[model samples]
Target: MAVDTTPAAPSHPEGGDSGGEAVRPLLSGAPAEEEGEEEELDVRYAPYARRDAYGVMGRGPLSPAQVARLVLAAAFLLPLRLVAGVFLVVAYYLVCRICTLFVDGLEEGRPRLQGWRREAVLRAGRGLSRAMLFVFGFYWIPMSDRSVPNAEDVHQDQSAELERPGAIVSNHVSYVDVLYHMSASSPSFVAKNSVSKLPLIGLISKCLGCIFVQRESKGSDSKGVSGAVTERVQEVSQDNNSPMVLLFPEGTTTNGDYLLPFKTGAFLARAPVQPVILRYPYKRFSPAWDSMDGARHVFLLLCQVANYIEVVHLPIYYPSEQEKDDPRLYANNVRKLLAIEGNLTLSNLGLAEKRVYHAALNGNSPRALHQKDD
Candidate 1:
């Protein structure tokens, strides 16, 4: 039988090939691929409540010697992690205060941030993010030293007025994706409106000028929030000096092995998008928030001495006629590219479906689930 040559759409996380037989390619700028199909990646996407889908964020479990080393390392770092956490909180407050002071001075006429004030905010955000990630035992390793290029260098067709990327979209896996992105570029984000109320984290996010999406708010109210996202993107895209905005279209976290359907909110902005792929590669502790309790996931990472993550930044995706005409295609194309570059399988399940599946797994089902193909 002649082998099938066409690339099929990436598979669902539940029924997809592993892309490789649990292979842990050496750390590099690109996703390491195997000779052929990855071992059948049978992992399922579920809430952290279920503990089965998150297989060690690598090929398999760690060796006894490796486990011993990790334990010893954790023991040696516990005190430092505690002290660093406290110091970071204080340091982050200072970063926010400095940005706010500058912003207050610059807000004379244009409500939108621009000029050197924006750069100061972005730089401060990145600095604080680096500190946070370090204290959390995670490292943000960019795939390449070439940072997000000026729109002129990477995608020139962008008109002088609207070329700079207003949106940086990425695949969401662990809860730490935001940390990694900020460490690379101080981009604002489209996050849940409720996030703005979450103590220090919320306060800092607001200071960073993040646009919050009301995921639970339904009907015209939610639509209004979505509209706000587009308006915000539009207002900021024309200015080269504005801070880049970032969002996770996946909207939900998945194991590093596959992608969930992307939400079109980011694409709705109709602005150029830069896709960044985040993969948490680990030998024992899976950085994925899937199937493990949220508290447990955080505690596990904190107890570990250090963890490594691969941050793959792909070329920016400029909107073509077709993409602009159909945001769904735009979102899918970007999602597809991230999956291919990250060596992850793709799925059609959006965050809603994932939530439904979680309920199903827990022996509960929605009374009338109206699933959308988009």
Candidate 2:
């Protein structure tokens, strides 16, 4: 049997071969080997000897430490949001007044000039809005799927045609969507006439050139809200310095996972429609409706949100080039794209996309009311 002189297989220390184990080259206190022997040992043992270190810690749910920190942060930041909200209302009113004054003056001097001075003042309101959210810990991740870039990136795109304004529409997910747009593009939204009545926010809307649409008044005078939106779009298109008109075609905010059918009013802007899709990747901690109630939920989420925001500007779709140039058709095209982009998140959560076959169609669903053919 040759005295059983074969070598025994090597043994590893405790912890097995898990990636978290640490390894050493040789036994501690062992004498150094000869150069040839060391080289031979390296060749023989290199592959199996090394061990991987543990990865950096991640926020899984919230640890005790994280919970404690979040609580403390919220305790400080929540009240701050309340105070800031008041300031925002006040700043918005002042800025709106200034803009309104300038517009009135411009109307007198050169009625053809499509300039709104309050946009500059709105910058302050926007800043305050961002700060309030920031103090609460709201974070955003930059998204890359959409061509509708942020204000800075918008300038870099030669094809974007900053001088040629268009109706830029997006799905409504949350009231935060409004703030997000204001921060990134400073575009005016088609707000309800009622929003214009809110103490401070309302006055601001009226003064800042918000296209206030009235549901009941649909005569030729202003098309009420619809007509107002058209005028706003025309004004924006006429100015080389104007912010793109941002509209929530869906007309209301959803829980962010589902997309509603877009209201046709935005499509009626007569300008080419610039379809924009915005998605917030909150991972496991995504702010859901169940997890977060309406307005109060938003305030709470602001404090615990991650530190990044993603705004994916997909390729801009032009209504002028799209088949069936009707606003409803253009809206469908946008809805389709959004459906594709947000399908996984929405469907996984059992949410359905709303349909907008008719402008008169309205539903309680946060998104549009569409039959899901899928």
Candidate 3:
């Protein structure tokens, strides 16, 4: 017998009964909330959202294939990379110690190292920094120079001297960002006072003429770190032989997608700055150091078979008269320029928001959070 197949008549029309409100399709793209209604606050909307900060690591459960890849990497790659990294650090430490052997006044303050000693330290530091990055799996780095009449094209004479920027301002994304900068320019950096006490790295930092800040001290500003930075900027501008001062005006790392409000410390002297933007384009793992613990970051970084960094160098930015009179104006203008050139989102959220996000991720109580100077 043939089966009957026919459509049933709808109890109500598509718009529902004429007097009733229209029925919406289940798959309709319209938002559930009414227009102009205030939406509830969500972690995902925050600039430094925990999900974005953690990248693929926090993206739910891993597949069996992913688990196998990680297992293989840990079993083989991790040990070799760790050993090579340590060896490079120790070898570079010895070189730094030897270079600074006859140099005095480091204990009192930063003293200018000239002649062969300076050359030896700078060259060795650059080479070893690149080597360390290689061990960590950054085999290739692509740098793009977008400076008008690029710094390299300028003649090495009075004109060049006058045009040189006092400092290189870049966004901070990870500790590896330091390695790239060190390899490229061997510039001095502003670091926390605690970093000056770490083994091997402490002496290396001092030898690099790093300016150390007592970040925990309430009177650190009065203690001369800011004054020293201003003086160093001026010094670098005037002295051709002086190392370029590198400052992360953001004062902290982010997820590499947003640019935070820049601190005025790097622009206080009103010296021209060469803005360099660094980006790590990744597939499975993000190279950003936003929310990961140091050890875990290192482990995953080494586990990855390959990684990449793209560097963009912008033209030297000169402060206008108004900016010169106001450091905040100088900083904001540069920040805006960087945001435009680098295609980065300008975020009002700064380090405080980052700290709160991290605290929440780690399950810390709200009261346990403390305000930190940016």
Predictions in order: lDDT: 0.62, 0.49, 0.72
Give stretches of model 1 more than 4 Å off.
1-76, 98-120, 139-142, 145-162, 219-221, 356-374
How do the predictions measure up, each by TM-score?
0.72, 0.58, 0.81
C-alpha lDDT of candidate 3 relative to the true structure: 0.72
Rank list by TM-score: 3, 1, 2
Among the numbered candidates, top lDDT falls to 3
Give the top-scoring candidate (TM-score). 3
RMSD of each: 8.5, 18.6, 13.1
Q: Indicate the residue-level lDDT of 182 in model 1.
A: 83
Residues 257-279, model 1: lDDT tens digits: 66777777788878888888777
Q: What is the lDDT ranking, best to worst?
A: 3, 1, 2
Model 2: per-residue lDDT, tens digit, 134-156?
64456444556556545553324
| Candidate 3 residue lDDT tens string, 190-251 | 88888877899988888888888886888786337878899889889888898999999998
lDDT of 2 at 211: 62
Pick out the ten consecutive residues of candidate 3 with the lowest summed lDDT: 1-10
